[model samples]
Target: MKATFGIKERLKSKKEIELLFSEGKSIAKYPIRLIYREATTEKNFTIQTAVSVSKRNFKKAPDRNRIKRLLRESYRKNKYLVSKNTTHHFTFMFLYTGNKMPDSIIVESKIKEILQKFISKEIEKQ
Candidate 1:
């Protein structure tokens, strides 16, 4: 099957996020903490990502929004690697635990590192 990402496959629902917190296994490697749960559906995976840029950090919504968008796009582009690697249904939550808003390249670099760790864990789980 051709693997592509969509809104439905991205974990955006509140219930889904809550479920992830309740049932997901966590993987942390600094800056990024991933929480994941097995998907019940046969043909889909979901991802929810959060970037921390609160009033205490950026003090502006636009800055936080931009960073969040960058994080999402980076994941959207690199997510194929994770999707193909998973043999069963799964959902992923990425929490940006950093104190500063990083440049896109930096975020992308951290994302790739985090994903590599995730892939390794999935391989070990097998």
Candidate 2:
């Protein structure tokens, strides 16, 4: 599978986003919180994700953007863990909940843990 995170892997539909927020189950790994649910639509990708950094925690736009960038990069690098051996399609929203900005290493490790937990949960549901 390609390791790159392309436009196809992003979660952008308004209806889907609303449904995800309204019905998705969430798991938290310190600074990161993942909200995910099995997709109702017949999408080709195994997972689609959105990243968020709250304005309350980060007052500056650049800070929020930086945090979001870090979140996306970490998720992209570790997404293969969730895609392997999975037949279901899922949508995820990753929220940055920490009061302070985190380095890439911290974000990546937390993202890895979150994805691993998500994969195990999905497996149990099968």
Candidate 3:
């Protein structure tokens, strides 16, 4: 698959977001946290994802947006790990928990690590 995060792969429904946070399980690797839950949706994609940066941590709109961008790009590049390993549909929220600014390399590595952990956890469940 192409390394793209298109509109269809985005999670935008309020009800779905609420359900995801309420019922999802999470895995964390330091500054990056992945909150995910199995979802039953009519969409064609295998996963729908959103990225968030805590306002409390960044304290500036530009800072938050930058981190969110980094998180999304990293996930966009590495999300094949999820698509290839699992058959279930899921909603994911990637939350940035650190207080300092992050570089692309750090974000990408952490995103890959967290995604790998998520895949391994799912395999164990099966």
Candidate 4:
């Protein structure tokens, strides 16, 4: 609700990440992909999330870090869409699948689209 991305909201545990990947469902919008699963967390947070950029696409650490930063920023701004609508807790991973360097506008717009799609899919599942 504070629009802050804090430590408790980060997906960091090795076990949790493994479980999410093993049982998660994924949605993709061109250069970005979302992998998510319903999960109960030890913390009070409703959603725990992580972002990744493929090392293969960006050979330089700075490039990958930059893209990851963009992904996190986009998600942070739009996280309320999922938080406000969902009754269940979830773990999420956003993967960057594109090779080119991205602009913030493009990343933000795509993140909105991707989250909309995810929300729609969740509705359909209900």
What lDDT is obtained when candidate 4 is compared to the true structure? Answer: 0.91
Model 4, C-alpha of 58: deviation from truth (Å): 0.6
**What residue pairs are clashing in model 4?**
none
Q: RMSD in angstroms, all models?
A: 2.8, 0.8, 0.8, 1.1
| Candidate models: Cα lDDT each | 0.70, 0.92, 0.94, 0.91
Question: Candidate 3 on 46-119: residue-level lDDT in tens?
Answer: 99999988887788899999998999999999999999999999999999999999999999999999999999
What are the runs in model 1 whose C-alpha is more than 4 Å off? Answer: 1-5, 43-56
Residue 70 miss distance in model 2 (angstroms)? 0.6
Error of 2 at 61 (Å): 0.7
lDDT of 4 by residue, 1-126 (tens): 878899989999899899988999999988999999889655589899999988899999999999999999999999999888888888999999999999999999999998999899889889
How many clashes does each candidate structure show, in the order listed? 3, 0, 0, 0
List candidate 2 segments past 4 Å from native: none
Q: What TM-score would every model get versus the actual structure?
A: 0.79, 0.97, 0.97, 0.95
Per-residue lDDT for 89 in model 2? Answer: 89
